[model samples]
Target chain A: MLSCTGYAARSASDPLAPFSFERRDTGPDDVRIEILYCGVCHSDIHQARNEWGNTLYPCVPGHEIVGRVSEVGTNVSRFRQGDVVGVGCMVDSCRECKSCRDGYEQYCEQGFVGTYNGEDRQGRGITLGGYSKSVVVDQAFVLKVPDGLDLAAVAPLLCAGITTYSPLRHWKVGPGQRVGIVGLGGLGHMGVKFARAFGAEVVLFTTSRGKIEDGLRLGAHEVVLSTDKEAMARETGRFDFILDAVSAQHDINSYLALLKRDGTLVQVGAPEDPLPVSVFSLLMKRRNFAGSLIGGIPETQEMLDFCGAHGITADVEMIAMDEIETAYARMLRSDVKYRFVIDMNTLAASA
Target chain B: MLSCTGYAARSASDPLAPFSFERRDTGPDDVRIEILYCGVCHSDIHQARNEWGNTLYPCVPGHEIVGRVSEVGTNVSRFRQGDVVGVGCMVDSCRECKSCRDGYEQYCEQGFVGTYNGEDRQGRGITLGGYSKSVVVDQAFVLKVPDGLDLAAVAPLLCAGITTYSPLRHWKVGPGQRVGIVGLGGLGHMGVKFARAFGAEVVLFTTSRGKIEDGLRLGAHEVVLSTDKEAMARETGRFDFILDAVSAQHDINSYLALLKRDGTLVQVGAPEDPLPVSVFSLLMKRRNFAGSLIGGIPETQEMLDFCGAHGITADVEMIAMDEIETAYARMLRSDVKYRFVIDMNTLAASA
Candidate 1:
């Protein structure tokens, strides 16, 4: 076992604080990463606070992981020492499952090994996540980060980027397509960027009128105040695709109506309470409501390469390791412009 | 105006009674059809009783129409004398809308004119449906019923056939795929037949084991009693697609669980109350809940052609025009084995 440092919530009701942990030693196909920056996702807050109720104790929750390859086992060929790398959402999965063979290991039927709060194949103990100093993972699950993109900002691209990217690609969001993005939060911001980069005419829908200027600057060609009935009526049955990134529980039917015949709306937000979806909303236009998790390994790499080629990076606020607690607090209030990335060098200096 | 004899509901709550009606003279693009047989649908019951709450007075409730061409206007070239034809759910739509132009006129932006209890472009009077001796419709809305299929048994194909076929076609049901058809009503039976005809391995899901034999006869490779937990559990996360055709409210999430990762369950049955779809069901497998109405004109023709080629037709119960009221009563009880097709020749003879 190797000693490591991270942040953990002692209990469900407790906030994250400094803690020490241990990671399994590198195996023959493992690559040990020194985590460079980890993006704080809304899911991290849900797990750290045990919002979904199954959260385990000493939960070191983070998944959007970007890092440096400090060491590699003898058999590892995908990465070597000093390589830039990333690990999003999962650390391991049964390689023999149908999902693993299909490149959708995120939905492994045998249960995937999560970056945090999930059991390994043997069901030994909970897996600690990327808020830690280092991790040992099978090389097959590690992604090579593109050389020139800012590693800190690129962290969110792994989770947020692919979460939005996968659906856009699956729905074929492309030229001459009018795409509507609901919300302008961390996920919505990425949706706009990707839709625009994919040659779509992007519209951002926000209830807050204040986000209008910011949404346009983030790559949206138009901003509609969702609260305005006139604006909504003007756009009804106009969109070819809608990416609903709003986490807050609201009327999904409103967005479903905005779609043209056979159009689709993909939800990436995992809201706790069940949303009431009107069947007529979908039947009316033969519309579809689907949910997509982060992309498969092949697609995630494709998204990163697309972002790199398009000169895209998340709008991230950098902070010292010690400021994480405050960053999480600000995150709950939607205080960050987009995302918060932790600078790993501050971890050693603070230690 | 042309006078016609038919049965209609005087009000939303009225039972079926004899009524004489009128249809406008054929326009340049119109074709006149002498009604032969009209299939009964669950929606006919919903509209006759105002179950969906918007049925107009003098509602002649029927859309799945089979008839012979009586005459064609000068500009109508698609059909001539002696052509056997059919009409499904709609009669007219704004032809210039994106949905109409894209071959999804069922979802026309300006709204397709419902075959019954709906108004026309001028909004002069409520349009009458095919529960009458004859109908006048735009040539674009008339479909050529192939010579091979039995006309009475093929009436339901206009509605139930295209309703099920559209979704199966959209989802790409084919060989090596496991498909599930929920419910054993009019739509479910058609769904099972269509899915099997598309070359998929078909499984019919019904609440009662009594439907086992009937399901296999209708082309199911197997039948699963949906109420049997052990049987359902044995097939969890296994289906590539599931068509849910139950009209009454039931647990939608139950059927959603049967879908494999990235699988879809399309709802053709409109339940009264909104279903509370669990986010976990969608999130875990990245699944989808989609809805489909009766198909567009082109697809309906394709479906009719496919059925003709496959020797497929609804297992129908024939009834005289006077038996329509009793048929409605039986439909309400789910007492009818399948569809009720009214013999228009009996109607004309009675007149």
Candidate 2:
């Protein structure tokens, strides 16, 4: 076993604090990563608080991971020592499932193993994620970070980037398309960038008027105040595809109506409650309502390559490892620019 | 205006009684059809009772129409007197909208006029349907009824038939695919027939075990009792497409579970309440929950042609013009197999 140090929530009601843990030794087909920067994702907060009621505490919650490869098992041919890499939401999936075979491991039939709060495949204890000193992952689940990109900003790309990228790619959103991004949060900001990079005419739908100038700067061609009934009504049946990144419950029907005939509205946000989708909204124009999870491994790598070419990186605020609890409070109010990435070197120096 | 006689509901509480109405004279681009047989639809019942809350009273409800052309204006080159023709749910639509220009008049931005209880496009009066002795329709709205198909049986093809066929066609359901048809009502029965005709393996889902033999008889390769949990559980992720034709409020998630990865469940049945779709259900397998309205004129024509080639027609019960009130009561109890067509000769004899 290898010793590790990270932040852990001792219980559902307890705040995350410093904790020591252990990880399985690097085995054949494994690459051990020295944790560098891990992005603060909304799901991390959910798991840390056991909001979904599935968390195993003392939970080490992080998946949007970017790090340096410090060691590789003998059979790990794709990666070696000192390589920059990433491990997103998933670490393992049943390779024999149809989704895995088709390169969509996120939708594995038996369920993909979450990077944190998940069972380790190699008989180790519960998997601790990238908020730690190091993580040993199967080479198949490891991603090579593209060179010349901001490594800290690249952290959110593992989860937020792939989450938004998969749906856009799956729906075939591209040039000459009018794409709408709902909610100007972490996911929405990335969605706007990707849609614009894909040569689509991007429109950001935000209830907060304050986000208008920021949205435009983030690559949206226009910003529509979604709260304005007159403005929303003016653009009825206007979007070719809408990427709804609002996690909080809102009327999805309003966005569903904005889609053109045969258009699709893909929800990357998993609200606590079921969305009351009006059947007439979809039937009216032959529109579609769908949801997407974090993408498969190959697609995640593809998204990274695309981001590298497009010079796209998440707008992020940097914080020391100890500030995660405060960051979580700020995240609850959506006060960060877009994302908060923890610099894990502070933990290493403290150790 | 041409005088016409049809049975209509004076108000929501009133049953159908003999009423006089008027239709526009045959204009240069119009064709007059003397009613022969009109298929009763579930929506006809909904409209008569103002179930949808959009019905105009004194509603003469019928849309699935089969008739003989009584007269054709000079510019009407498609049909002449004595030609067999049919009319479905729509009478007229704004010709300039993108939906209309693209041949999907049913989704016209300006709204397509319903066959009955709809404002007349020519300023004559509220448009009466084929329940009357005669109807004047735009030449473009008239479909040439193919020779050798039973006219009475073909009447339901205009509504239920096209309604089911459109989604199957739109979703590209074809050979070697597994298709599930929910419920054993008018739409589901047609769905089974169309899926079979399209060379797909059809599975009919019904709550009643008694429908098993009838389902197989209607071209379903197998029938799954939807109420049988063990049976339903055995078939999870078994279908590529499931056409939900059950208009009654039921758990749509159960059917959504039956679809394979990337499978779609299209709702053709318009239930009164919104279907509470679980987002995880769609996100898990990347499944789609969509709605499709009745097909466009061109696609409806294609469906008719396909039915004609495949020797497909609705299994209908013939009734006199006065039997509609009793038929409506029977329909509410799911006591019809599977459609009721009124014989216009009974109205002529009474006159």
Candidate 3:
């Protein structure tokens, strides 16, 4: 076992603090990563506070990881020492399952092992995430980070980036299509960028009027204040596809109504409470309402490559390790510009 | 104008009674049909009682019409006098829209005219449906019923059959796939038969155990009482596609859970209230929830042809025109075998 240090929540109500733990030694198929940056996801807060009622403590909640490979086992030929890589929401999965075999390990039938608070498939203990200084994961799950991109901005691509990219690509969003991105947060911001990068006419639907300029700067062609009834009404039956990234409760029917006949709305955000979906909205135009998880390992690499080609990276606010609680509070109030990525170098300074 | 005798609802509370009305002379693109049979749909009850709050007074509610063409206008090349024909939910749609041009007129951008309680596009008054002695419709809205199928049994095919069949075909429910049909009513019964004819391994889900035997008889490989927790639990992630024909409120998440990864559940029933959908259920496996209205004119003809080849027809309980009130009452109690078809020949006897 390798000794490691991370920031973790001792209990649901407690603040995350510096803690020491042990990680499994680099196995033959494993790559040990020195985590450089970790993007804060909203779900990290949910699991840390047990809002989803499934948190295991001391919980280290960070999945959007970008790092340099510090060590690799004998069989880990794909990843060499010092290679920059990424680890998203998953660390391991039952590789024998259909989803795993099909390159969609995120939807593995045996349940993909989450990066934090997830039971390690190898029986090492609960998997600790990138809040730590280092992590050891199987080579199969590590994604190659493209060159010439800001690694801090690339962190969120593991979660927010892949969450939006997979759906847009799966639904075939491209030129001559009007795409709508609901909310302008961690996921939505990336959604706007990707939708625009995919050669689509991107519309950003945000309740915040302040996000108008930012949404446009992020590549949205139009930004509609969703609170404006008349503006929303005008967009009715106009969208070819909509990517909803709002985790907060909102009327999904309004967005569902914006789709053209046979259009689709894919939700990447998982609202705690079930949203009341108007069947009439779907039935009226044969519209579809679907949801997507982060992404598969192969797709995640594809997203990173696509981002590299398009010069696409999440607009991020970097934070120190010790300021996580403050970041969490600000995140709850929707105060971040987009995402908050923790610089792991600050971990030792906090200690 | 042609004088006609029919049963009409003068007010929301009034039971349908004998009334005199008029039909326009067959126009250049029209086909005049002497009604032989009209199938009762649950929507008819909603319209007659103004439950949808949009019903026009003296509503003649019936769209599932199977009859003989009594007259055809000068330009009506598809049908000749005395030809068997059918008409479903829609009477006319703006043929210029993309949806209409794509042969999906039911999703017409201009709003396809409902056979009953819909404002006509040609300056005619609110259209009265096929609860009458005759109806004159545009040739584009009329369908040719096959020669061999029982005409009375074919009445419900106009609405219930097409409603179920369209979604099944759209979702590609076929051999090697496991399909689920929710409910055991008019639409559900037709859904089971069509799913079976599509060569799928069919499972019927119903709240009532009494329908188990009937569900199997109607081509279901298995009948699982949806209310039986253990039975329903065993079906988790089992279906490739599920056609929900239930209009009543139920736990939609339970059904959503039954879908395999990337599976779809299409709703054809219009439940009065919005269904609460767990975003987690859809997000976890990337499942889809969609809705489909009744099929287009061309697809309706295709469905008729498909049924003609498969020797399929709705199992119907025949009733006289005067027994509509009793039929509606029994329908409310879910007492009909599957559908209730009004024998238009009995209209004169009731008068």
Candidate 4:
């Protein structure tokens, strides 16, 4: 067993604090990563507070992981020590399932093992995630981070990036298409960058009027205040596709109304309560409402490479490990510019 | 002006009764039809009773029309006197819009003119539907009723048939796929027949156990009571596509869960209220929930042709025109076998 240091929440109401745990030693297919930077996902907060009603404490919650390979087992050939890599949302899956065979491990038939609070498929203890000094995962689940991108800013790509990118790519969003990003938070900001990079005419629909400038800076061609009924009405039947990154409760029908005939809106956000979807909205134009989880292993790697080529990285605020709770508070208030990435080097000093 | 006799609703609370009205004389691009059969749809009830809150009274609500051409204007080439023809939900649409230009007049940018209670585009008056003895429609909106099918049964094909057929065909439901049809009524019964005829393994899901036998008689390979928890649990992640034909309020999330990864659930029924859709259900398997309105004019013609080839038509219970009130009452309780087609010859006797 390998000794590990990380921050964990002891219970639903507890603030995350320093803790010690152990992970299995490297197996033949395993790669041990020295955690470097971890992006804070809204889901991390949901799991930490048991808001989703399924939390195992002391929960070490983080899935937007970027790290360096510290060790690799003898059989591992795809990665080497000191190689920058990533792990997002899943650590293991039943590779024999059709989804896994199709390279979509995120939709594994037997259920992909979540990066945190997931029972180990190998019968080891519950998995601890990237809010830690180290994580050992199967080489198949590890991702190669491309060169020339800021590592901290690349962390959110693991979760937020892939979540948006997969749907856009799957739906074939590109030139001559009008794409809408429904929020301007962690996921939405990345959605704007990717949609623009994909050569689409991008529009950012945010409730915040203050996000107009930031939205343009992030590559949105136009920013529409969603609260403005006339502005929203003007966009009706105009969008070819929309990526909704809002996890908070909001009217989804309004977005559905904006799609052109045979258009689609992919929801990557997991709002706690079900949204009331007007079937008429979808029926009127033969529109689609769908959801996409984090990308498959192959797609995630493709997203990373795309980001590297486009020089696209999430707008991130770097925070020390000790500042996680404060970051969470700010995140709840929608105060972060986009994402809050924890710099793991500060862990020891904070401890 | 052409004199017309039909059953009409004076107000939301009034039962449909015999009335007399006038229709525009046939124009250059028009095909005037002597109405033969008008299939009763659940929507006919909604419109006549103003359940959708858009009724224009003395409302004449019927769109599932199969008729004989009584007259044709000089510019009409598709039909001549005595030719069999049909009209579904739409009578006219802006031919220049992208939707109409694409042959999808049902999704016209300016909104297709409803057969009943819709303002006539030519500025005559409110367009009365197929409940009347005659209807004048543009050549573009008229469909050819193929030879060798019961004309009465074919009436419902204009609306219910196209409504179900469009989604199944659009989603590419075919051989070797497991397709589920929800609610075994006018729409569900046709969904089962079409899915079966298209060579899929058809499963009918109904809240009532009594419908199971009828589901099989209607060509379902399997019938599962949707209210049976154990039976529904056994179907999780098993369907390739599910056609939800239910218009009543029900838990949509449960059906969303039954889809395999990338599987779609298309709603053809227009429920009065919004359905609460869980994002998690859609996110988990990357499933799709979409709504398809009645098919495009081109597709509707194709559907009729396909039905002709397959000898498929709605299982209809023929009724006199005056029985429409009693039929609507029975329909609200879902007591009809499948559909009620009003025999137009009964109109004069009832009057």
Interface root mean square deviation of every model, in Å?
1.1, 1.0, 0.4, 0.5
Worst 10 residues of 3 chain B by lDDT: B1-10
**Candidate 4's DockQ:** 0.84
Sliding window of 10 residues with minimal summed lDDT for model 4 chain A: A1-10
Q: Point to the candidate with the largest lDDT.
A: 3
DockQ of each: 0.68, 0.71, 0.87, 0.84
Enumerate the chain B TM-scores of all models.
0.93, 0.93, 0.94, 0.94
Model 1 residue A34 lDDT? 92
Q: In model 2, what is the error at residue A9, expressed in angstroms? A: 17
- In model 3, what is the error at residue B232, expressed in angstroms? 0.6
| Candidate 2 lDDT over residue span A180-226, tens digit each | 99998889999999999889999999999899999999999999999
Query: Tens digits of per-residue lDDT for model 2 on B249-345?
Result: 8899899999998999999987777778888888888888989999889988888888788889999999988888999999999999999999887
Ranking by DockQ: 3, 4, 2, 1
Model 1: per-residue Cα lDDT over B258-322, one tens digit each: 89998999999988777788776887888989999888999999999998898999989999877
- lDDT by residue (tens digit), candidate 3, B144-225: 9987999999999999999999999998889999999999999999999999999999999999989999999999999999
Global lDDT of each candidate: 0.84, 0.86, 0.90, 0.89
Number of the top TM-score candidate: 3
Q: What is the two-chain DockQ of model 3?
A: 0.87
Candidate 1's displacement at residue B207, Å, is 1.5
lDDT of 3 at B239: 92
Ten contiguous residues minimizing lDDT sum, candidate 1 chain A:
A1-10
For model 1, what is the error of residue A30's alpha carbon versus the real structure, in angstroms, after optimal superposition? 1.7
